[model samples]
Target: MNLFSDIRDLVIDTLAAMQGAGELPEDLDFANVTVEPPRDPAHGDMATNAAMVLAKPAAMKPRDIAQVLAARLADDARITSAEVAGPGFLNLRLDAGVWQAILRAVLAEGADFGRSDLGAGKRVNVEYVSANPTGPLHVGHTRGAVFGDALASLLDFAGYDVTREYYINDGGAQVDTLARSVFERYREACGLEPEIADGLYPGDYLVPVGAALKAKYGESLLDKGEEDWLEELRDFATDAMMELIRADLKALGVEMDVFYSEKSLYGTGRIEAAIESLRDKGLIYRGTLEPPKGKMPEDWEPREQTLFRSTEHGDDLDRPIMKSDGGWTYFAPDVAYHFDKISRGFDALIDVFGADHGGYVKRMKAAVSALSDGKVPLDIKLTQLVKLWKNGEPFKMSKRAGNFVTLRDVVDQVGADVTRFHMLTRKNDAPLDFDFDKVTEQSKDNPVFYVQYAHARVCSVLRKAAEAGIDAADATLGDADLARLGHEAEMTVIRKLAEWPRLVDTAGRANEPHRVAFYLYELASEFHSLWNRGNDEPGLRFLQEGDPATSQSKMALARSVAVVISAGLGILGVTPAEEMR
Candidate 1:
């Protein structure tokens, strides 16, 4: 049960009563009314803007409306006191029984306590970590993978039918370069000096692909021309790289539901169909774009090209779909890819891209909007760069990847759980610094460890309770006398626990998984604070001497924190630490 939602409904019902009694206007919009936690906890448990938002509409002063509403709210048994503050806002203090019910709900629901149905099972396709099949995934792609995986999990938890997807960039010239790189390695395996061309991939990771090729073709492809072997090698090299990429993702515990090929859009009439759909909508036409503003007019040549009317759908300007030579531009295939997604009947689409792809956002959105006739909304999230630090210095690049740190490099040093949790410590669009020293250190400063430690502490309490011959299982704790948990310190932690369902819905709606990390940290802080307080006040301890009843009641509260933490960490793709060593 969402306590905030319950209180909001109470406020709404009270307002409707006011209208029925002729104390307020009959027809007033209460859609803007909100019940939320007060900015300052000292003020009250919750606050509402019902009076403030309804003042002008109701033809009444905010304070006048608030005064009457406070009296109406105080009539409810759940609302202990409703006080008017700050001209119009009504702050509410709920009865202690309300928090007790929330704790009972936590034990009853377990991990599903915070699950939301805000999405209503709408199909959402989340495309992320679409790195080119050239090498192992690097640090930038690592951030995208973690962010996207967590986001997909969050959406699923919020009741969205989420499909995690990765688009292969194998149709580009880069794959051709990869073919040549593998050819060199194949030559090296054939007992010849392999030429490490300047523009070709020089990483030794391709050496195994070359050895496999040699094993298959023997000396038959040794003297073959580029035309004869390029196509076969392109497929072979990409498939090999994809296998390695999958392994890299596996190391980080990421698995995509679909692996879309960029090549599938080509030579299959898909691109033509997508463009024709835009043409039928009068959004596609032959046109010459205005030269860029900073360019010299004399040097600018205006050539006719096929363009999409992207500006009509919120882009800054129309975008070209095809080049002057009649070949599809990079944007054309992406449009076709999204068109395929739309054809599949998804309710919404989300693309998680690197910061470098920021320029493509508006146009891609415009394409999906036009293609889906604005029925399906597309949200694009850009993950900024991740700077790796080790031993108080910038982490060096990987020899396997040649130029950047591979995802495996980071995952190998720190396990997948730590890597995933730490990566989400910042928003997708914010730059993140992954410090090995700080993240691995077992201290309160480390958020991952801190949160995990709270879960472990709960487990420790349960273990000690069991050793003392007290039944601390969920079934037993859930039935414990929760009314005994009336201390202010205990209520504080329960209040934080009560926010989980609201937090899940908010994070899911905003498509911001970082909020989950932030919430987990705050919840951990509240739990740890209560745990520390137990040292000075023996009465606050979860286990009491010669008082089994009180001990079970307090232990129930501690178990509720673990339940929420486990649920939160599950959304982040991090395993809850049963024991932190």
Candidate 2:
């Protein structure tokens, strides 16, 4: 069904035939040969570098080989012409019937047209949005959440066994701070004036956690010391905050398959086991780290510490696993967590982190490399900051979240579909500007609206064709006289559709889901252009006047565009618009 792949295979088969006819050497490697769209459409439909790549290796002139290859390819029914241009590049022009067959393939396959098996069912663990379970998720976490969730979906479509995961940062001192903040709210709920001290979480979201704690423990636990209440309240508050986090994710249509707790690694011998595994490999040692570059800290001094030889595994320097006070450092638990992931036998790992954690990327990768002995690959994607705009100025923060904008605030204002689509307009490594006024604007300038409008227009076409008593169902239209779709505008759309499978494979291989968003925009642009062209050219319209036979063929092409859009939007976790409001 992938016309590009089909054509590429034809080119490779023809090269093999040329080798058999003694036109090229038998030892020439064909791995470098590639068939893709020509850089300038005016040149041809597709281009191949088989002649150019094999010329020097086969000890023959590129044009001489291209001439022979061109003659062999011209014998095939799919290729109309293969012309040698500029040294050795072979540009190919496919027959019009090839595009007709592609349209029929789209009608037959529907949403599953572009699905690929690129990963071959390899297990991949994608961990993202592992924000601290202290309060509601803010805008930074929102980008990571959307990026990670969409990546998981994209990989799933590309045939990877994806496990959507969230690593809870609940084992650190941040949770203790959360417990103290909830204690203040608990006092307020008990009719006592609470102390909203500095360094405590002041968000009103904790008000309910306090109320729930009061209902469960009553006045009995209020008089206890920190030792008695800290552990109990930390567990209670983290659970409540996680519940709030879950609801926030649900609003944005994100659901994790695994919520791995960092606390589970503590007091479970898992940390020791992970460290011991590295120790057995001679990667653990006790040493004093060199002073950091540039200005030294005020208390700079060398001290003996337990360190991991992270430099051996690609880190910039060895990292301390234990502080001078003999307690585990902040990175110890992270090492244990990744070691556990390796023990589970995943073939690959991907972590989606906020831009602030860019420095942690190398060390984390080193840990996984040492733990897995370089058997698995770890890909860390950092989602950059999002700047929200509205009313000609930066958007205001959520009062409920205290200082930052909550995920729910964005979703509630612009809706989940718009929020999700707009968030992915930029790549994960690039900064994004989310303009509230612009995203909701129903114009071509707005990508989300333009793409959704295209889907809605296709639905309108289906409805109109059905009302006209023309059978436009996939099965009926799939068998229509697709040869009537010979117009350049119609063929342009089919050309874009043909790139779907190739696009899926490329995006999956690079771990970039933003490419899907970009492709959808281009496909929508082409579809809208053809729809507009139909106004003046009567033969270009999807529904022909009083001719169901002609109308069905064109309607089939329009419906195929909708099918691909739905499939692309599905990967992005955005529901396709049935009708535009």
Candidate 3:
């Protein structure tokens, strides 16, 4: 179904014949040989650097090898012309029937045309949106949630065994803050003036947690000191916050396969075991470290502490696992958490974090490397901040002003489908602007609308064909005489359809799901352009009044575009619109 792969196979077969006939060297390695669409369409349909890569290895000039390869390729029935160009590159023009066959292939395969087996069913764990369990998810977590969910879906489409995961930061001081914040709300729910302290959460979202606590415990915990109620209240409050987070994630159409807890690492001896494993490998030791470079804190006295030999594994400096105060640093539990993942037998691991965490990437990678002995690879993607816009002004997220935009706020305003699609329109490392006014517009400038419009247009075409008493379903269209779809405009779209399998492999290999959004935009553009062309040329229309065969052939192409559009949007967790509103 992949025309590029099909053409490359032909090129390899021709090269094999050249070696067998003694026309070329017997031991030439063709691993670097490639056949792809030329950068400029004027050059040719396809181009290859086979001769250029083989020249040095074969002890021959590039042009000399290209001249022989060109003649050999031209003899094939599928190749119309194979011309040597620019030192050693070979430009190829295939038979017109080749494009027609691609159109028929789309009709035959439908949405399954672009699927690839690049992952080879390797198990991959993608951990993302692990926001601290302190409150409902805010705007900062939305971008990572959308990006990671789409990435998991993309890898699944490329044939990877993907597990979507979330890690809860329950074993931190933040959960204690959450508990004290909720306690104040509980007093307020009992008709007392709640003290909104400087260090406590001041949002009204916790009012319900307060009310729920009163219903569960009455006034029994009212006068208790920290020792009497801290642990129980901390666990209770954290569970409530996680429930709110789960609801928030569901609003954006995200689901997690696992929700790992850092607290689990504490009681099970997992952290000690992980550090012991590193110690056995000579990667952990008690040492005194230099002060941080630039400016020193007021209490900048050096002290001996337990440090991981992260420098040997490729970090700026060996990092302390335990502070001089005999407490675990934040990075200590993270190392143990990933070790837990490694022990679970995952072939690969991916973490999606905010751009503010960019400085922590190297040490995290080094920790996983030393822990797993470099057997498992780790990829951390940092998603840049998202700036919200409304009425051409920046919409700041400030909790005190009660003006902060939560994930629920955005989803309720625009919608989950629009939110998810717009979030992925840019690269993960690039800052994205979410304009409330722009995303809902039905204009072509909005990619969500543009892509949805393409699908709706195909639906409109199918309805029109059906009203004219023609069978327009896929079962009927797929059996159409697709060779009749031979127009240049029609063939142009078919050529784009042929790039889907290649696109899937490229996007998956690069660990980018944004590329899928970009490709879908381009595919929709090609389909829309063809639809507009049909308006001026009556013969290019999908419905032929007198010839059902021609109409069916053209309808097959349009429906095939719908199939691919649906499949691509599905990977993005977007439901293709059957009709534009």
Candidate 4:
């Protein structure tokens, strides 16, 4: 049960009663009325802005309105006390039984306690980790993968039909560069000294791909010219790189529902269709854009080209759709891809891009808006950089990736669970420092260890109770007389549990998975604090020597806390620790 929503409804009902009594006008809109926690805990448990929002609309003084609303709210059983505070706000303190019922609901629901239906079954397409198929995934891709995967899970829990997608950049010139790089390795495998050129990939990760090429083609293509083997090598190398990327993602426990190819837009009418849709709205035109302001490139020229009027849809400037040589711009295929998503009947589209792609956000959103005619909304989230530190210094680089740390290197050093949890400790757009020494340290500084320890502590309590023959199983605890749980410390734990449903809705609405991690850390902190309080007051402990019912009730509350933690961790793709090993 959402106690905040429950109490908000009570406040709304009381306002309606005031309207009936002519204490407030009938035409005042209550949409802006909100009930939330007071700024100071000593003021009240919950505060409402009913008087402030309605005062100007109803042509009445705010304090006069709050005084009448407070009297009406105090008549409800759920509201134990209501008073006007400051200028106009109405503060409310809910009855103790309301917090008590929330604990019982959590125990009854298990891991499903905080699941919400706010999405109402809308279809959402989440596209992420669309890296070029030139090499294996690196540490940057790991952060995007974990963020996107957890976001998809969060929307799913919030009742959205989420589709995880990856856009393969196989149709780009980068894949052609990948072919030439593999060809050099192929020569090295064929008993010839390879040319390690400046623009060629020099990583040793492609050694196995070259070895496999030797196994497949042998010496047949050894003496062939560039034209005879370029296409074949391009196809072979692209497929091999994709296989490596998939394995890298699997190592990090990420799976996509679909892998879309940029090549699919080639020789297809999809690009024309998407452009035509924009042209029909007068958004496509042929014109030369003004040279970008300040420090113009040497090659900047006023050449006429096909452009999209992206400025009409909130972009800073009109974007080019075709180069002067008549080749499609890099953004053309992207427009077609999002058009395809719209055609698939998704209500919304979300793209997770790196911080470097921040420049592409506006034009892409303009394209989708024009193609869908404002029917489908697009949200683009840009993830910032990750800095790696160890031994009191920055980790230099990865030998396999040649430029950065590969996802495999991080996962191999610390297991996937630790990597995933640590990556989400910050928001997607915020810069994160991944310090190897700090993350793996077994202390409160490590969030992954701290949260896992809370779950393990609850397990230890149950195990001890079971050894004492106290029937401490979930089924037994759920059926216990919860009214015996009257201690203030015990009620604090229950109140925190009641915030789970509200927290789920908030995080899902903002499309921020890091909030779930932050919330879990806060919940663990509260649980740990209550555990320490038991040391000062022995009667507040989970185990009471002479009272079975009271002990079972307290255990029930602790178990309920465990249930919510497990559920939140599940959304983060983290396995709740049964015992810390």
Report the number of the highest-TM-score candidate.
1
What are the lDDT scores of the predictions, listed in order?
0.94, 0.93, 0.89, 0.89
Candidate 2 ranges beyond 4 A from true positions: 56-61, 297-299
Q: Per-residue lDDT tens digits of candidate 2, residues 380-483?
A: 99999999999999999998988899999999999999999989999999999999999999999899999999999999999998788889889999999998
The candidate that wins on lDDT is 1
Instruction: Give the lDDT ranking, best first.
Output: 1, 2, 3, 4
Listing every candidate in turn, what is its Cα RMSD in Å to the true structure after a full C-alpha superposition?
1.0, 1.5, 1.9, 1.6
Q: What is the lDDT of candidate 1?
A: 0.94
Taking all chains together, the TM-score of candidate 4 against the true structure is 0.97
Candidate 3 weakest ten by summed lDDT: 395-404
State the lDDT at 99 in candidate 1.
Answer: 90
Range of the 10 consecutive residues with the lowest summed lDDT in candidate 1: 397-406
Q: Tens-digit lDDT track for model 4 on 1-581?
A: 67777788887888998999989889878988888778886787789999999999999999999999998888888888998998999998878778767877887778888888888999999999999999989889999999999999999999899999999999888888888889888888988887878888888888888888998999788789889998899889999999999999999899999999999898989998988888899988999888788846776878999999999887899999989999999999999999999999999999999989999999999888888888899999888889999999998788888777999989988888889998999999999999998888878889999999999999999998888889987777877888887766666677678778888888999999999999899889888888998899898888899788888988988898889999999999988999987
Candidate 2 displacement at residue 478 in angstroms: 0.2
Task: Please provide, for model 1 over 308-352, each residue's C-alpha lDDT reduced to its tens digit, 9 standing for 90 to 100.
Answer: 999999999999999998899989999999999999999999999
lDDT of 3 at 19: 89
